[model samples]
Target chain A: MKTSRFALAVCLLFPALAFAHIGQGDIGGGLVAGFKHPILGLDHVIAMVAVGLWGAQLGRPAIWVLPVTFPLVMAFGGILGGLGLPLPGVEIAIALSAVALGLMVAFAARPPLWLAGILVAFFAIFHGHAHGAELPDTANAISYAVGFVVATGLLHALGILIGVAQRWRGGAYALRGGGAVIALGGLFFLASHFSILPGLDA
Target chain B: MNHFNAGFVHPLTAFEHVLAFAAVGLLIGQHGLQKAQFLILIFPLAVALGAAGARALPGLPLVAATNLVSLILFGALTALAKPLPHAALLAFCCAFGLTHGYANGSATTAQTSMLAFAAGLFAATFLVVAYGAAAAQYLLQRKISWIDIAVRVAGSWIAAIGLMALAIGMRGGLGR
Candidate 1:
């Protein structure tokens, strides 16, 4: 009985040790960790949702294309990160995506579909690189990839839902307001990362 | 015998492979078995050839890509239910089966008799496809629109999974 208990205790500690290096635990497995990464980070959540909102605003083809383009490009970014390639200022750029995408939503800026795709894909590299850089060494790569990609897509879908609210009266205003809020959050994230915001650097 | 068993069990092991055939089966159910007769008959033969080809040429490019695309295309087709030409549908099934068979074939070792492995694979595919089609056909025939909707939603999820796999393959980002 004592041996079994000791085995259980050691098993429990393994997961903790696995996650301790990244400074984020509470979640286990590479796939689950990857899934939660986007949702856990405020910057990733806002930017992903903002992409969906922007896609919804742009309407069909953009709706699907934008979401699809992100992971594809993000994967390329992941490859770069995995290969130990340096991409300067990934954190700053990720924060900037939220700001830029949020502002696009707030102002109801409608860029051409190609342009929107390009913009979203460009930011996705930083996001992907961040994810790739932190991948758990012991985690299942396929599952982790699946988890994060799906999580990102779901966030985009959530934003699309919010953007679709425009079908109702004053829905457009509500969306714009939501965009402003996301943009505000992005600014704070950017500030916090740069230690520009008081008490956030800690 | 172990080789035969391995071949039989191979398709069942992977979620993606099971999902691929299940999607095909679901389509057959939705459209009626009669309409999909050619698909039902030709898919296994094509898979056999693919598995053989894989054994012969281990360096088949785009096997993963093709498999992923099959998932996406089939899932989308299930969701849309857009009427397609018979030939188009047949071609889609054959192409999907071929890729999956190739993957399965390549996975088997040289010690495994290719014939036994192929037989096992064909048998497994047949059972899965037939059972899925029958189940969907029976349950969905109840005239419940929501059931149809649920199937469509499942289709979307499958497509999403495929898209995720595609991204991973593109970047080889999943940690080794």
Candidate 2:
């Protein structure tokens, strides 16, 4: 009787334990994958950070405006991509975004508010398209989208946090230096996309 | 899960629901505590009514779609960080609460007692909204410009999530 009771308990517990798996192609899995998508890509990471750094460098409304503009516009691009609407040269545009945005940071370029918003919006489309197009078929779409967008936003926050250092003397130089490195990294990615960088092309 | 526990956990389980609830609280809280206190009551009442009415409603999908729209609307309103006409805001709160509550209600099993489940749901939803309102009130009291900006940024994040989710849903990839 004791053995039978124990066996019954084990049977009851097994299914519950089995159902506890995390990231196993459920909403949680989709979220994890989507969150990882932007962070895992070096190109995406730098470009997103550049947006924050540039925003900080510009100060005021631009600081907040650029971050707001990116995600909303990115969602539009994502919609286009989800619908299988082809935007020509997505890869090239993504690579170019990094370079251009990074260079803007490196130079601490502060264009007019509308111009800056337009520039950021332009690059956001490519990034959003890349993410939307790459969404896994098995994943929950909403969760996955939430994951990537949140991840992207956090990356911007990270850049903004780092950019805050600019308030101190000599911090500006460091920020500009960071931007140059990002620009260089973007160049490497651009080159690899063209197969011009040996072994770096993934 | 028991009916009460199931109903309690429903809003917390879904990302969109959580966002929408928090956005409503934040938006209301932005105005002032008195407004939040009075306005917040409308949500649970509407929720209870919607949940009760869910048995008669035929289209679960429509409720869900509206819920997503509510997510976007609330997030955008919060991000705008501007005051709106009181009546309009009230209407938004009631409509959203109804839709979201209906969605929550449809998830219930027939074996459960409706009263117990609704009580649990009300408790959970109220806590989330109250917490959000309190947090926003705290930030407003600080009078820090950056805090306001951060709130706006958070609002944008919510809106972005809604937009992406809507797009993906439209693409026929939501539940898949």
Query: What are the per-residue Cα lDDT tens digits for candidate 1 across A70-149?
Result: 76677667766655579999988988999999999999898888888889989988988888777666665445655776
Model 2 residue A74 CA deviation in Å: 1.1
Per-model DockQ: 0.11, 0.42
Scored on chain A only, each candidate's TM-score is 0.83, 0.86
Q: In model 2, which residue pairs have backbone atoms overlapping below 3 Å?
A: none
The weakest ten consecutive residues by lDDT in model 2 chain A span A16-25
Question: Candidate 1: which docking quality band?
Answer: incorrect
lDDT of 2 by residue, B1-176 (tens): 35666567666667767788898888877878876577777887777667777766745676767877898899888888888888988899998898888877776656667777777778778888888888998997899878988888788888888888778777873434
lDDT of all the models against the reference? Answer: 0.74, 0.81
Q: Per-residue lDDT for A28-110 in model 2, tens only?
A: 64899889999999899999999999998999999899887788899889988877899998887888888898899889997
Angstrom error of the Cα, residue B42, model 2: value is 0.6
